[model samples]
Target chain A: MSSDVLVSVRGLEVHFPVRGEGIRKKGAGVLRAVDGVDLDILRGETLGLVGESGCGKSTLGNAVLRLIPSTGGSVHFAGTDVTSVGGKGLRELRRRAGMVFQDPFASLDPRRTVAQTVSEPLEVHGLRSGRRERAARVGELLELVGLDPAVAGRYPHEFSGGQRQRVGIARALAGEPDFLVCDEAIASLDVSVQAQVLNLLRRLQKQLGLTLLFISHDLSAVRHISDRIAVMYLGRIVEIGPASAVGSDPQMPYTQALLSAVPLPHPALERERKRIVLRGDVPSPSAVPSGCRFRTRCPYVFEPCDDVDPALQPAGAAGQQAACHLHGVVGTPVERTPEGVTAEP
Target chain B: MGARSGAPRGSEPASAVTAGTAPVLEVEDLRVRLRTPRGPADVVNGLSYTVGPGETVAVVGESGSGKSVSVLALLGLLPARVATVTGRAVLQGEDLLTMKPERLRQVRGPGAGMVFQDPMTSLNPVLTVGRQLVEGIRAHGDVSKEAARSRAADLLGEVGLPDPKGALDRYPHELSGGMRQRVVIAIALSNSPALLIADEATTALDVTVQAQIIDLIENLQADRGTGVIWITHDLGVVAGIADRVLVMYGGRCVEDGTVDDVLERPAHPYTRGLLGALPDLARPAVDGVVPDLATVPGTPPAPTDLPEGCVFWPRCPVRGDARCEHEQPPLVQIQGLDRHFGPSGLPHRAATWCTEPTSDTGLPASGTGSTALGGDR
Candidate 1:
């Protein structure tokens, strides 16, 4: 693992047992939401995970934070392996990490005031001494997220969508965690309010020197806040590179298509740009395709793709890695293909 | 002109040149007030717009900005007991507001079809996709069951649904979100309505699927000359599909112009704020640094209790003048600009206001204590 890496995940997999009909077939099937995936998040940097729904980006994030139990693999956070920890050690692991959810309304306690919600973290961790001190800390946290300190008395229902999200942020920051996993934090917000929340998150990250794992399906929002982006397809990280590099020149076919699919705000550019629209919906996770999961919809699929699943390998640019057969390693194709193998697509 | 001449001819799209004549739907001074527990909330203020034949007018607004309510009022979709709708919606030369319920029902699917945001809510869970499509088709026209079924199959295929035959038997829940959306689109285009209203149609689907649906709509519009009203908050999608853009804020059209004019050189403060707030993926990194997003300070006013004068005056950057505070700004047509502004000019127009331009150039930053935040991500 790199010295700068704050969170190191290796071969992480999360599988949920599928239930059948009413209640008869309890353990009928296994849905592998997050399959063999490896990622490294540098300290104080936002690593964005972008993919469509059911692609396991959220599962991967939850696994890293140990919010959900990982069926396989290891997640090393700070100096301890999160997967191996339990009881007191697990509580310690949680103290150093926090999660911000997608829906602020659902995530927050409707009955609890903003202060109670924010102060609960302080109480759980036993961070601040005395009731007065904790109340003051709660106000400070609310202010940090650009909310009025007086708003600490109001309940979740009293605040707007943006204000409720700020309260959620304040609650997350109350723990003073080094690592934060924001799972589609702004997905539910309006466009105008979306920007405000994004700006706030960025400011908070820089001010607190917090390491963040910002997972979202919205490519534009992810690109705006992420230092490095990892494009997930099915359950794997198909491409990982600097935000600018990936945004400008994506090596993976899935990454390329995902970027192209995003509609640019400018009308002229939107009309001019050609889109590589993927065929068919994303296949069910339980019945994932063999070899390469993306080959079913991949535009540049070849014979090698069906027979062998490509692993993340170095690409043309530094600090960039792509899991694709097109970027032949060492100026030669990695897999020896028979004649006419490339003509299949 | 109570003519049914512009009904579906063939699958081939109508010519773009024909779009210049009569607009498919013309709305004038549309207002919808909902009797909520709090009070009579004016959801849709006096709004007017026209969708020309084969033209796509994208109505962009945040939630509760009356974008959806305005369309619902035009279509008579809002509940009569709860909503008091007053508008003149002339569709194909007939005013929808004055039309009888029976006449309006005939015009709904055949005259103006609609595709909603959530496909699940729009579709029946128990009924098969085939049955629903056929029902919609046969409801408007005098078609046999066999003919309707075949048309449904063709509609499914046209929307790019895989295995149209097998999909017809499957229920709505059996299909994926994208597939269900396609089914919704298929049903919407069953009778080839003159006007198609898609309210956040692709908002629920994945980006890749959204692209596909967008392409399908554009293609269908081209072949059928269907005037589309795409109501959505997504500026990016609006840029790609809309011929003209209508920006709604605080239950009114703050700005209206061509997609190029509005997006590239926005004149209204709210429109400018919306464009500025968006995080552009195509935006070049400034000296290898991610810029902080500019935000419109303060939340939108409550619909029931909107501030006097300009609806956006509370959040407007150049909002210190007495005229702006006491009197609402009329939607003035900008001469030679090929666009319309609420009251002010571009940032250059801000220079004429009381406050001096704070920024280096004529573009005056909003004086509402709003900061342009940028940071290296």
Candidate 2:
């Protein structure tokens, strides 16, 4: 809706129908994977999307990229309604927006060389004049991601996991897209390699002036890379704020639990820190709980949480927000100490 | 903690072996080769380590570092037709490397147990989870089916699985990823083996699930007095559980010491590079758009196309000249519990090359006929 916004998703819902023979399940049953999500990614900022497994974080990212069709609402990219765009319009939109997948080994064609893998997008968009120019551009792209140009002739199998991911990044940047969605791109890599790739992505984003929608289940990694973070729970945004604010002082119960679960690198801190372990496993999306999706496992859940759904409201300092009744007077008032002081447990 | 007291007492003395008291599973000069189209490709070479009775030893390295291959070779799991293994893998006064096929099969489930990377692939899809656990139990022990089923249920419960009775009747697909991994652990622990090898057991699971599974494995080992050889590439997982850490590179133990010694003050150049690359929350943030991240350039050399001297010399950031390029640096103990590649194959010595501090440039000079010490290439 605004010029500064690169991608705006409002109430976007992606649901798949589940057919069964029992209990009025003919047409009423539907698996609401990505249900009613609202997010805004600015022009050149990295917006991180995080959640546990089966919490619909990946589904939401895919739906925003228009890789998967949404059942309801709209996605507006640079003032263009991507949901209504089709045929040539969709193809044009794809050129301006690219996605880097989780598994680099599976995403790249095994038969293609590194050069071909990076140049395929350029060929598809018909951006290059001749083979020579395309080859040169591929070499430059490889170097941009810290890979050697000499490695251009090698196949994907010859490289390690980190190198393959670099190739994937080079491919994503080939079409000169303004916005990119990296869905768990670093999850399959080792920790050391993960840091390298994350650093590379940040450098490339700044150099190219690109906006990134980084989706991952790893909290520490997302905190390191994101400018602002949005915490998702069962296809809904429970909290949205700056990365530092959300990580250090979480307002929602879900956010608090998620941050607490991350083990600190220092052994002393890890031993002293209290972990908020949720009792049960995550509920299935097809049978999501009514009202608050996290109410089933929320540690601070009460009677009011089951009946009334809380909307996203300002909770943290300044512009941060959270959708939880704890901040309100409905269940228990979140006790706050004096300014700049943390309430002791 | 309450869990610490629940640990079985018989295994307590075995933990001292990691303190150089007595080694349980000792492997020396272990070498494994496969007959490829390009002649013999050494998958595991000159790997040496010891896992005490109750100590949890971690062999950490990237893929193809010979961690998994060495463990599989010890159990005689590699196919005899394609692979040729040599050297000593002594377990409870028996040489596993020289044992007969039939004898090895008998010793596999009882003497040593193994859990693979992916539980779904390791388990049979058509068979029920209960039947699989019972099969592992009955394969080595003399027990009735009813007794085995009950023991299987208890094992499942020990792994923190909900409704062990109900889980026994369900197939692998019905359970979640975490639940399936718990079932695999139950199967691995069914025989009460003295030694357990978990090869990337929790690498496929989510972070929370990974933590839970690691805790479960550590608990089980404490109770059973089972020596553990945890093979993984994740440093985070290794830091939490390992008593002694062995840093492997290009099929050799480059560094081996206590977890605190290796993690806090890593002496090997490779080990230091790996630790420096890790994103620490406690560290101060770097300026500029991109943070200063340590990355080793070039890929690990393939086993078939390994360099002549040190296998890591091509990618080593602190690459010295003639010694690193002309002769293989043997694994030698360095100053104060640190181990690294050195010229002489002696103990209690540091690497022969300069012990200069690592610079922030992230890339050192390549070995270009210039030696740190005056030597011929």
Candidate 3:
């Protein structure tokens, strides 16, 4: 993996104000969606960001691409501050970085043909000059994502879920971006079809040498394509390391729990696996736990974990880092599950 | 093939489903044809399976493989005008498909319960959890509202929902996805149903929450002797929970066997392909590069335009076999009755022409696609 940083993020934070407009009155609080996240993407490596539903993984990914506004911190793309740029520079950043959204059904327009949908980026970025050129480029992009260009005339409704995802990929790659963020790209696809889309993304990444951020709730899919994996919780990344190192010998208790929770496909192995059943649900983002967000459900939570949130440091495994008190980086490592510990909502 | 896997499950007789007790739910020749805008579509075709007491029968398939439709059809959840369901579904000695509307409604709560994929949709938005739970309980019997209310709280407590009493007063929107799912499970178990149909129930939750919910369901099933029909596309979950696995393709049970007989020695080519597509976590990346996933080449056939013969023939990689193209293959026995399996008398059966050719078959590695998933399983 290349050490040259493609995208450098420092203390990136994205907070959403909970509004009680029409429906049930939600208490007024700032939901710290992406809170103080620091990460770096290698020049051509695929980094998988994994977490649960409300972990702000998607928010962090959007912040990296400047798709959504952030509350605090800075995002530097290609050695330049992406947060400061506006107008043409911002548009240029958008062109350089493409985002493939989660839902393919909602991402594409029902009225627009596949060609029109794919060429929208090319038109906006003014990549291909003429209509004929744009159509040709769209065809190339379609082929790049393993779609037949002949179906370019058809509407989005005519295609299957997997095919619609391929069209979405084609649109995301229209501007010839150096960086791509696939936010739950294959989550909506079927089990068999997910692999097809994942394979296509891996192939495209290799062919173009594009820096990729594949964000998904599914750890198995994330582990498959990512060279490096980052395990996020609530808002912060608890662990980041080489995919094999993290997937195999994870240092962080949260990472360990997350890995153990994933059900294996082998019956013998699955039955024999030691599953760490977390007590309660993920704490609400609006009311995140005092110090470490994961401490509420962490079985190995210590006194230091409740006071001082440990920052990412060199963990036990090589090239792996974890932000946990159990690392003994500062506090005593809590090896056993604390007794009589129960978290309340 | 390492067929003698010790099966490991026969030891715990109390919790584990026994060999030959009468099935809680027996579905035979089940078919559901829907009247879509295009035309009449056969969503489910000739499905057969049985779920004994405390048995977890997992129906594994892709999205439109009729996993969900079959369950919905049996429960009479599909709109009557749009659906044509013809099946023999005996749930707790009652025919779900042929029963009258009122009888089916009566059977839904105590006889058979369903926990759907989306918690937001399954629950009543306007009604509180306590009210809904009590209403379900009172509808079945002449219990007092106060008694039903306490019972509702007890059900919530049983489901491991925190502050069960306080949670009953709160709305579904107030709870997290995992919490909402717990409430749904609590309601599903309110009447102590003999069978529970969870259609992609934990798909919405994260891995950790999913595990908790799974454990809860397993424990509940063990205590109540409730047969579970778990409909999910996740092979990982099917591995952990299922006593019997039914691999569905194009609305048909392509393969049905014990976890070992299917997962370890997958008979049907489709099952093999499905297992091949999964990414095993135990697998290590080579030089920081994970191996390429093996994808089944094409998407599933749409219900409106299903193939004339074998539904999988259009995408089945094992092509040149003449029997595979024009004729629908029946469930052929892949392996005879294995004494090791906890649930007895059920052999490994695959509805494909490829089951007989075990030696030198072009099928992918039987377990997960990875090398680490090979013999260790």
lDDT of 1 by residue, B1-377 (tens): 00111122112322352345888888999988999999989888888888888888899999989999999888888899999988799999999998999999999998999999999899999999999999999999999999999999988888888789888999999999988998999899998899999999999988888887888888778878889999999999998888778998888888787776677766666777788799888785889887887678989988899878888888877666666666766665544322223222321111112222133211345454221211211
lDDT of 2 by residue, B192-279 (tens): 8888899999887766566567667877777677888999887666766777778887777777766655565455667766776765
Q: If you superpose only chain B onto the true chain B, what TM-score does each candidate give?
A: 0.87, 0.86, 0.89
Worst 10 residues of 1 chain B by lDDT: B1-10
Location of the lowest summed lDDT over 10 successive residues in candidate 2 chain A: A336-345
DockQ metric, candidate 3? 0.52
For model 2, the superposed segments whose C-alpha errors exceed 4 Å read A21-28, A111-120, A123-140, A147-161, A190-193, A263-273, A329-333, A336-345, B1-22, B284-290, B336-377
Candidate that beats the other on lDDT, 1 or 2, i.e. the better one:
1
DockQ (Cα-based) for each candidate:
0.54, 0.31, 0.52
* lDDT per model vs. reference: 0.83, 0.77, 0.83
